[model samples]
Target: MIKTWHLGDSRQSMVLASFDGRLPEVVYWGPALPDGESHQAIATASAADVSGGMVDRNAAVSLNPEASQTFPGHCGLSVRDKNGTPLAPAFRFQTETASEHCLTLVFADNALDLTLTFNLALEAKSSLFKLQSSLESADEIIVEWLAAPVLPVPAHADEMIEFSGRWCAEFLTRRVPFAPGARVRDNRTGRTDHAHFPGLIVCSQGTGNTSGEAYAFHYSWSGGHKMVAEELQDGRRHVQFGHASGSLPVGRTFRTAPLYATYSENGLNGAATRFQKHARNLVADGARSPRPVHYNCWEAVYFDHKLDELRSIASQAADLGAERFVLDDGWFGRRDDDTTSLGDWVIDLRKYPDGLTPLIEHVKSLGMEFGIWFEPEMINEDSDLYRSHPEWVLGPADQIRGRHQLVLDMSRQDVRSYLYEHIASVLKHHDVGYIKWDHNRVLPVVDASQTEGTYALIDRLRSDFPQVEIESCASGGGRIDFGILERTQRVWLSDSNDALERQRIQHDAALFLPACVTGSHVGPRKCHTSGRVLDIKLRSWTAAQRHMGFEMDPRELTEQEAATLRMVTGWWKANRDWMMQADILRLDSSDPAIIAEQQLAADGSRFVAFAAQMRPSDQVLPHPLRLTDLDPNAIYKITLINQDEAPALSRGAPLLKEHDLEVSGQYLMSHGLTLPWRFPETIWVLEGRRL
Candidate 1:
């Protein structure tokens, strides 16, 4: 017997086939197929020819590749009985469920009484595919590893782009070629660590930003994850993503997180725009519109929380058009520093004798909504909560600490209750509108339930106080994933406020995150983290590229710097409503030194291009910056918005610098714009309006 099924949106489709009532495997996944295309024929054509040394019939790389089937590559599921004896499950198709946009398949291993199920859904608008797998047994079993539904990699794809980075430098992209053996990435760090971002982009050779075919995958689990891109000896290739191996304890049922995948015919931008739209329209749908301009005090004041100093800073920030002010860290417990105050959510009497109300009121009086920081998932031995209940900590008592702190046992009901109560008390008392939810340390043990518990707590709070917003900050960009983003509204992209670093980080992160949910802030003149000093123009424009904010001490800015910053802040505010919905398109600059992107408005009526010269070009002349995703027939009036900021060294009078020039979109995209020459560390901002 043969069974075939397919699900798709307008842009792409996925077809799965099952033979002999066995588990299903994806046969075709790419551009949308014709309405009458035969899925059975596609499945038949997907088969490989048998050879002498190989088994009589090559075992299918089914959804749940089984050891019993003798499938040569990595098996999809690994489990054992309670007594440590391994159980080889042979799943046979039992039932199936289908919906308009979703499909579910069930198979059972009658001997072990084990049932394995797979759920696949295609998001209607974004055309992104979501797949997951679940397992249930009659008796308790230990699940070593259970992968999501496996899908085949296109044979034509030659290289895959994977994400990796360290603290203060996240979302670094690396390209790996598709070779003979398996290329596996196993992230064992309890949370989605900065080292692995749980995303991959597989592209055919010669694929660039604007053109060529590409496929993207993101494992949506905030906890540790494992990804495998393997090429079998016979040349068949498959990709699998799931929770890290051995992360789940012995249980009767196990389920993997949703694996988000999409196929793009228009290159990296096609996949990026889909992910960005999905994140904004679905993941962060509940977030407030006209996202408020933000000012965070971490870089400005560090752990010092003097009321008078903070009130003065709030006044300055407010005058500079900051709509919200967040008092970050050191506001609670006896926490003068990072070491002694985590997990004690109570307001520190030493820092605020009258409690947070005074500072919150002061910030509110300055016409800015108040926000405060909390590291609820972590604990310090010096904290009152930890002193009272040392047993609440996760992992072994002798386990080493991270950032001088231990992780709270989020899985425990009592622990969740305690944290909710304390955090809720503060929210109830103050007129707070935002919470900078921070996770400063990684868990000592990898437990999926811990992430579930954190989700529960955040869900409960968001349910009660729907108006309050939360920003996910795990030492910045550490715990950023779809799972965490579903609960929080914004992400602190990186802790390093250096514009030069942020320029690259933001550009790379645009693949998965939309500007509305990415918080970019202007740091001090001398970046505290990188110690790189940049001009106010570069700093201001970099922050303006996303959900703009300021983290520097407003009092430290000179008159000239303040005026320039104020002018940029005004421009951001004026354009934010539309820019929030704009698609950030990374421009293809021929010049190696220029890192540029164009934020094309959702309506395709206007766009603003930011071409930042990181260093001196190898060639003396500047390269024409080519834009993307514009109407070829339309004429656009292009003007350099920051022409006045050009340094004296830029003596040449480029047409953009002198006055506006009306040009065809074809000309702008083909021949491109010839921007005025500028010094390194400077950016050219060009505004284009369709006419």
Candidate 2:
């Protein structure tokens, strides 16, 4: 799709890109390819673009203009008209390499068909690259890159492009995914990088005071082009690039040749769809997200929960008007906590005389939604399934060793079929309205032979059973990826339930996914990540707008805490409309104690700003706080939740405090009433508005 040329000598190097209007493209950084005279002709067949077969290439073959010869910094590739014009930005965004790996663009198709030939003993290798051609296909994409596999000190001393890894030994979709894999080449002087994603990674070549240099390669797609950034992994470097907004899904496969990465035909669409990110359309007007602000029953009872205990919890939830009740770990067969009896989806009859049916009905009787948890992706070594077909567990496709914690071979067709049938039976048998889909481990080993099929069988399973809402949890944030989001409703923020940990965690997460990302708040005292106490205001504020829920036992709360929760419950029920669709703004974060505020609006007239106060101390300003989203001049009635409700105060009276935006330290900081004072305050309810 995008093509670039690299002209480098022992001294300096220049990389440039040229487009033929084959696709829409953009450039985030400059010094692109200058139009040049034709000097060479193709000896073989050539027709602009080839759609699939990218999986086979060790990496891209074309080069870009103006890129760091030492390290491929954040330069990009874009396609253009025959006149070689640059497309503008819309869906495309400039990527930044922060501490973590940055994935700019991802594209997938059912099949990829490309071929590479390495002479095995030659200095050079030739490959035919193909890409995003057909709009539809649900098969495998084939890629063949590598002169040969690296076998220690190559017996032949030849530069080769061997399959260091299978970008897709096996994959699913109508096409293949632009999977990330790298090939490091050491022809003479040192090692050169080859990656599956775009951007340059500055590897440690014994340079500077660095402890082995490494650059985070950023992958991004915009307006029909792909761009990347190379940032020093060492903490001493901080490159604050602008944030990417709107939508973008580009395809720029990273492969290895040597010197630098190059592209050919079918350049990435800055705002195109990815190989895996298909927006299976779960949102539309009035189509409320299936997520709920309900509590989890685990920490409340551990694995010792009985039917009666569950029913009691359900009763309290209903009293608080909670819409859902989830029955966590223990209920399945003999399984309890994380120890034994996992992989046993059957219910433990000893826990109840009447089985899950009665519990489901009872939860339903309380008029709340019912959901169950399952760790189907894995099994205990002692599981009957393991004993019956141990080969179904993940092991070396070609004799790789170590019997890991039993992982279901979702890559196998038989395993996929069997899992689907069994789970469907359980689901159809219950009156459950939701399923908490959890996969608690990492996948480093895979056996994806033709007989095994794609490990993405989970996606197909969700497609087949779309009736109930699915909340994904991988011991918290483990398996979180864009692919999984297409099939589920929400994901647990982390295994740690600490409110403080969540403040940072949730912020980092929302940088990518949408608001449906859910966070849980265990009650009053210590819980989750931090066994530390969280003030009610703090917990509520941090979790508001996201899916808010209570986890700790209710009766344990002091009368004051119970009263506070009751208020939250009522407020949540009445004002949920705003939380779902309103735009959000960050108010304050100078203090971790002040988690901050978010507001949503239906029209220009209906708006609500929600703020939660965590740690209240001398650090808090004594001055009035000004709200950011406030209308500069509109006067409206404000409700200071607690103050307005005090019996000593009159109704309709001004719990209303005047809020104004003033300059403080070269910034527009809001001046407003302080916390607990406005704990449940409805900042303002605009009758006739301006904001």
TM-score of each: 0.99, 0.59
**Per-residue lDDT of candidate 2, residues 568-640 (tens digit):** 6667656666555443444444444443443435353444554434444345232343344445455543444
Q: What is the lDDT of residue 77 in candidate 2?
A: 24
Compared to the true structure, candidate 2 yields what TM-score?
Answer: 0.59
Leading candidate by TM-score: 1
How many residue pairs of model 2 clash at the backbone? 76
Per-residue lDDT tens digits for candidate 1, residues 593-612, read 99999999999999999999
Q: What local lDDT does model 2 show for residue 24?
A: 17
Error of 2 at 301 (Å): 1.7
Model 1 lDDT at residue 348? 80
What value does the lDDT take at residue 67 in candidate 2?
A: 20
